[model samples]
Structures are given as C-alpha cells and as structure tokens.
Target: MGSLVVFFQLAGAVALLLFGLSLVRDGMTEAFGVRLKMALGLGTRTGPRAFLSGLLATLGLQSSTATALMTASFVERDLIRGRMAQIALLGANVGTALTAWFVSAGIEAIAPVLLFSGYVLGRRKGPVWLGTGRALIGVGLMLISLALLGHATEPLRNAPEIAAFLPMLDAAWPVALLFAAAIAALCSSSLAAVLLILSLPLPPGLTVVLVLGANLGGAVSPVLATSGLGVAARRVALGNLLIRGLGCLAALPVAGLAGAALTGLALPGAGLAVEAHLAFNIALTLLIWPFTGPIARLLTRLLPDEEREQEHGPRWLDDAVLKSPLLALTGASREVLAIGDAVERMLGQTRHAFDSNDPSPLAEVLALEDRVDRRQQQVKTYLSRLGRDASEEENRRAITILDYVINLEHIGDIIDKGLAPEVRKKIGLGLRFSAEGYQELDAMFLMTQENLRMAQTVFMTRDRDMARRLMELKVDIRNMERQSAQRHLIRLRDGQPESRETSSLHLDILRDLKRINAHIASVAHPILDEEGLLIESRLRMG
Candidate 1:
C-alpha cells in the first residue's frame, strides 16, 4: 500500500511539473510581444542569423524543437539555405539546455506575487494589460505546480522500499544511463529525466552520464515528428538527432574526467549537476558550431538525396516542428503563398483554355489543382500536430493560419470544381464570347491575377497598404463582373446561343472569377485588420 501510494505521488509530481512548465512556456511567449514574428522572418537569411533566430525563437517559446521546426520551414520555403539550417540546429541544442537551467533554478519562486497582480490587472479589460496579467497568472500556476511536485517527492525521500534503489547507483554508470534514456523516452521530455535525476542523490559520474543520455533520448521526439515531411524537414529532424547523439558519443568517453573534475571542485547542494549539464551543452555547441559545414556534408552523405526538383516544390511545414505553433504558423503562411502562386497559374491556364478550346490547358489546370490539394492537406496535418505541441499564443496563431490555409484550399477547389466545369461546358456548346465581351473577360482575368498576387504579397509581408490595394481591386472586380454578366445575358436574349450550356458557362465563369478575388481578400484581411487602421478604412468605405 505504501509503494502504491509512493507511485501515485511520484506520478502526480511529474504531472504538476509538466503542467507548470507548459503554463510558463505559453506565458513567456505571450509576454515577448509580436516582434518575435519579425525576428523569425528576418533571422533565417544566413547561417549565423538562422542560429540566432533559432535561439531567440526557442527562448521566446521555451521549446527548442519549435525553433528548429521554424528554421526547417525556411529551408522548406527556400527562404534559408540548407547549410544555415544545420547551424540553427546546433543553436537549438544550447537553447533547450538553457530551458532546463531555468527550470532547475526554480523560476516558480515568484509565482504567487505574479498571480495576484495578474488577476488584479486582468479585471481592467485592456488587451495588452490583460495579456500581461494572464501571463502573470500562468507564472503563478507554474510556481504552485512546481511546489506541489517538490512536496510530492517528499514522500519518496523517506520511503524504505525506494531506499534500496538509492545505493544501486554506486554500480556501473551505463545502468544509470540506460535508465535515464528509457525514462526520457517514455516521458518524451528531457526535463522530466533531468528533474528525476536531480531529485536523486546519485554519484557525480552517473548523474552526468544520465543527463547526457536524457538529452540524446529527447531527440526522439523530433525524429518522430518528421515522419511524413519533405527532405528539408526530415533533415531538420535528423540533424537534431545527430547533434544529440554525437554530442553524447563525443562526451561519453571523456565525460568521466570532466564529471570527476567538476564534482571534486563543486561548491554545494547538487549545484554541480546543473553546472555539469550546462558546461556539457556549451562545450558541445562550441565544438560542433565550427564544424557544422562538415556535419552537413556528413549528414548529406548519410541520408538519402533530397528531391528538390519534385513537382509543386517543397512545402514549408515539417512534422518535426509542429510542437512550436508559432513556428508552424509561420511555415503555413509560406505554404499558403506557394499554393496561391499555383492558383494564379491555374487561373491563367483557365483563361487561355476558354479562348483556345484546348483540352491541354484544361488538363494542366487540373494538374495544378491536384498539386495544391496535396500541399493543402500536408499543411493541415502539420498544423493539427502543431496544435498538440503549442502554447496558447501559438495555438491562437496556428488556428488563424489553419483557417486561412483551409480557406485558400477552397479557392483551389473553386477553380477545379466550378471554373473548370464552366470552361468545359462552353467548349461542348461550341459557343464563343463576342469580341467586346472577350476583351472585358480578358481585362477581368488580368485584374484577378493581380489581386491574387497582391494577396500573396500582403500575406508574406503583412503589409496593410498592399491589403488595401487588394481591397480596391476586389471592388473593381465586382463592378467588372456585374458589367460582364449583364452583357452575357444580353447575348443570350439576342439568340446568340440561348442554349443552356452557353448561358450557364458565361455567367458562372464571371461569378467564379469574382469569387476568387473574395478569397484573396479574405486572406489579406487578417494582416490588415491586425490594427485599427484597416477597420477604419472599411468603415469609411461603407
């Protein structure tokens, strides 16, 4: 009965620790404000920039995997080069270890004060203040949970059944290493194993080895995350694994000497263990940082070749990165841009197919639609996985991106199911647009393409001015569509193919073209309406 009670208590401790850390992770990201996005956007241009970007992103989100995944998306989108991704991967290792340091230092000690002040501020009903207050409340909860975990472990300190296991650590270090690895893999968190090891008064050598193994085992999460992702994404996951694995391999033989020195020179209260972990990560990063070029070459040789020339190109989302919702959302935006480009091409083909009566162009349009569908589904799945791993701020942004991408996919469907059908009907009827009507249709088609491009640009840059321009073009499209539909109706009444196929084809084509603009406008609205400026414009327009 005592053993069972102890088991429950230990389990509760773990649960509390995870919950507390999760809350703090989310709160910190929210507190960092929005500059993080711009930092991410600008940071991945080169190797060192990507390295700093990964560090900043992980620091903000409190998760290294998220930063790594975000960097992977840059590669997937061709925003950053693959070699830069290798550098970023190395940085994420240091970032994750930094998080463990924060955790071990008991940042939760100030939770109560933060909680009270946060609740007081939360009642004020201001956006920025409320967000800050909520973050404080999260910090408080995190502290309370950490306290709960510490109390839960108190029982194990005196339990005789577990006491027998205490002296078992005096044996070979590999036993402790295996135990740490298994614990970390099962928990799916390096912090979990770190805390467990920290709670025990194990020998210095065994403690260092266990922490090393814990770090290596934690890479399993990233490895598993890239299961169905593209080459760049897979490489990101593989890179994380290699860094951890090689770091351990390099440290394994020499870890004893370092651990002995550190233990012998220690100050007090298990502080040496934390210092040892920190020193290990820092030394390993320095060792690997300069050699990232060689590591990239080695990984390239070890892993199979990337299919860079694959049709529809690389998607930005990688399964390994879904844990960081902010990073994943960033990737989804890039993916949406790619899909938008493909849509513009399909629309161009549809326009030409209408005039040429060439099934070849129509077939090409269909192929583009199919490719967009695949990319859309890939992003959706990635977001769903990301939602599972994200903090609340990340979750909110992810939801927005997921909604936007799904909406964009519908635009692709409109071309496939709606516009394509109209073109085929016109061909079958053997009826053609009158000269003036053809010219008007051509103008509208050109405007639609421009609007699509503007929307993609606005999404990429989050430029309110570009979004405003897209809105203006949408209004122009509405007027042009109205005029074209009226002219097509006149042609029908004048006995110029009063046939069902001809009438339906002409009117439907105009409606689908206008609807496409509406979808683009929707995509642009999120960026523009982020501040009150776009809303003021809309009200004035109304």
Candidate 2:
C-alpha cells in the first residue's frame, strides 16, 4: 500500500510537470504565435541566426518538439534551408537543456509568489496579458512539481526493490539507456525525464546514461510527430534524429568520465543531471554544427522525394449519376470542393513563397494552377449536362456550384499569374517591404486564406448564420485593405527605404489579395439572397 501511494505521488507530480509545460506552450502560442512565426520565417538568413531563432523559439515554447515541428513545416514550404534547419535543431537541443538547468536551479521557494502574480495577470482581458500570465502560472506549477518530485522519491532512496534494480541497470548501460528513453518517449519530453532522473539517487555514470537516453528519445518524438507530413518535412525531422543518435552513441562509452567531471564542477544547488544535460548539448553543438550541410545532403539521398498524383481531372464526376439531378448536383458540389482545395493550396504556397522569399515553393503553385484550370473546365462540362431537364431548385444548385468553381478558378489564376509573379519579382529584384508594410500584407494574406476556408464551409452547409458572418467579413476585408493602403502611403510619405523600394509591388499584391477575398466572399451571396439577408447594393436613395 505504501509503495502504491508513492507510485501515485510520483505519477501525479510528473503529470503536473507535463501540464505545466503544456500551459506554458499554449499561453505563448496564443500570445506570440504570429510574431514568432514571422520572426522564424525572417530570421533564418544565416546559420547562426537560424540557430539562435530555434533556440529562442524553443525557450519560449518550452518544447524542442514544437520547435522541430515548426521548423519542419517551414522546410516543407521552402522557407528555411535544410542545412540551416539542422543547425537550428542543434540549438533547440541546447535550449531544452538550458531550460532543465534553470528549473533545477533551486527556484522553488518563490512558487507561491509566481502563482499569485500569474493569477492576477491572467484575469486581465487582452490575449497578450492572459497568455503571459498563463505562462507564468505554468512556471510556478513546474517549480512546485519539481519540489513534489523530490519528496515523492525520498522513499525510493531506501527501497529494497529499487536498490536491487539500480545495480542491474548500472551493470547494463544499454538497457538503462533504453529504459530512460522509453520514459522520455512516453512523457514526450526529455526535460521531464531528465528532471525525474535528477530526483533519483543513482550513480553519476548511470544518471548520465539515463539523461543521454532522454535526449535520444526527445529527437525521436519530432520524427514520429511529422511522419504524416511531406517528404521534405520528414527529412528535416529524420536528420535531427540521426544527429542526436550519433551524439548519444559517441558519448555513451565516456559517460562515466563526463559524469565525474560534471559532479566535481557542479554548481551549488544544481543537480548533476542538469549539468550533464547542458554539457552534452554544448559539446554536441560544437562538434556537429559544422557538418550540417553534409548531413542534410545525406538525408536527401536517404529520403528521396516521391511523385504525388496530379490533381488535374475530375475524379468524382460520373455519367451514371447524371440520371438523377440531385445525385449529379452532389457530385458537382464535391468536385467543386476539390477545386476549392486546389485553390487553397495554391494560395498557401504563394503566401509561403512571398514570406520566405523563396521561389522553390512557387513551382507547386504553377502546377496546381494548371490543374485548377483543367478541373474547372471538366466540372463545367459535367454540370452543363445536368442543367437540362432539371427542377428550378436543381438548376439553382447547379448554377451555385458552377459560380463557386468559377470563382475558385479565378483565385487560382490570380495566384499563379499575379501573386506568383509579384512574389518572384520581389525575390528576383531583392526588394524588401518595410516592417510595417510586411506585417500589413502578411495579415491580409492570413485573412484571405481564412476567408477561403469559411467560404468552403458556407458552400457545403448553406448555414444562415455562417452566411451572415461571411458577408460581414467581406466588409472587414474591404476596410482592412483600405487601411493598409493608407498605411502604405504614410510610409511612402515618410520615405521608408523598404516601402519605397517595393512600393508598386506592394500595392499590386494588396489589390490582388483583396480581389481574391472578394471572390471567396461571393460564396455566401446565394445563401444570403435565398434567406433575404443580403441587400442588393450599398447605394443611398434620395
């Protein structure tokens, strides 16, 4: 009964630690997600900057896994080079180690103060304050959990079963390493696993091996999390895993010497596990940072890109369904949805290219635009046959589907012809938007993508409330576009160098994005018209 109680206490403390980590991650994301993304997108111009970006991002997010995943997504979008991404992960590893060191630095005495301050700040209204407060609360809980962890493991210091097991684990370092790796993988956090190791009374060599195992498992979590992503993304994660695995293997035989060295120089109140974790990462970064390019090349050879199916033809349209107008309309609607998906992909790729100043992603936009053109033609031909000998409602539905698909095709064309070229010109000409101008355009790009998604939902469900919301968003988009243009003019008048350099390009892109949003918002029109919720015009009568 006593053993079970102790086990639950340890489990509960670990759970709280994980919860605290989550709160910190969520709070930071809510508060600074966009700016962080922008910073990451812009900060990878050089290897050192990329490394620092990853380090800082991991420090804020409190999870190297999150940092890795974000970096992988950027790679997929061609935002960051593969070599730079590897270096970034190296820095992220160091960041996580630094976090462990800080948490175990005997700071639990102020947990209550932190908790009180966090509660007060969390009660405020704005997202920034709330998120920062929640993060503070998480820090407090993490410190408290560390204190609890120490108390929970006190009984284990003298437990006969643990005494018997420690020798067996120490004797087989490989098994000990795997055991720690499993715990880290289960918790999905090396920081948590290393902290748990700190609480245990074990030989220095054994503890070092356990900490190494946690690092190995930490790298694996990102690879596993990104398994379903694109080949480029998988390569980034896999490359990070390989680096850590190699580091672990190289350090395993020397664990005892390293652990003893760390023990001798340990800071007052700092645990050996924390010291070892930090030292190992620092050593690994120094040793492997210069080899990132070769490692990235090796990864590409190992994980060659696979050819994906082209999205050109209509897969859902069928002649057998043409006999039933309702079934035909359903098939047409589904096909149009596919077109919408294609348009969304094009828009996303273009936006990514614009932000990253990389043209590699634009290749997909061109391919998708061609597919969109072909598929829309196919859809139009298929729907035209259904229009003959159809009821009024069926005819109306067919027209709606046709109109939506046409709008989607137009979006695809604008992305391929207008936005793609404009982004290419910006990249090719080495043009830069002022910070304010960049933020303005980026926000609209995000809003346009969001509106496209909402339009898709409105198309499928025809929900009245959603239709109303879409119409309102149309007004919001117009106002935003006007405001951004006004801001651009103000910047121009101020003679901002970046704004002046990209003046015409900036205004042209803004116009195109607004046009795209207008097309997307048109999906809500038929729904609103049917419900009498749409006004015919904004004209004033005398």
Clashing pairs in 1: 225-320, 322-386
Candidate 2: 10-residue stretch with minimal lDDT: 33-42
Each model's number of backbone clashes?
Answer: 2, 0
Task: Tell me the RMSD of model 1 versus the true structure.
Answer: 17.1
Give per-residue CA lDDT, model 2, range 103-145, as digits (tens): 9989999999989988999999866788889999999999999
- Off-target runs (Cα >4 Å) in candidate 1 are 27-34, 45-48, 106-108, 120-134, 158-163, 167-170, 264-270, 305-537, 540-542
Q: Which ten residues in a row have the lowest lDDT in candidate 1?
A: 29-38
- In TM-score terms, which candidate is top? 2
Work out the TM-score per prediction: 0.59, 0.80
Q: Rate the local accuracy (lDDT) of all candidates.
A: 0.69, 0.89
lDDT of 1 by residue, 147-242 (tens): 666666777777775567756764656676667777877776776667767666566777788888888777777667766766767777787778
What lDDT score goes with residue 458 in model 2? 94
- Alpha-carbon runs more than 4 Å astray in model 2: 316-341, 348-364, 374-410, 424-501, 514-542
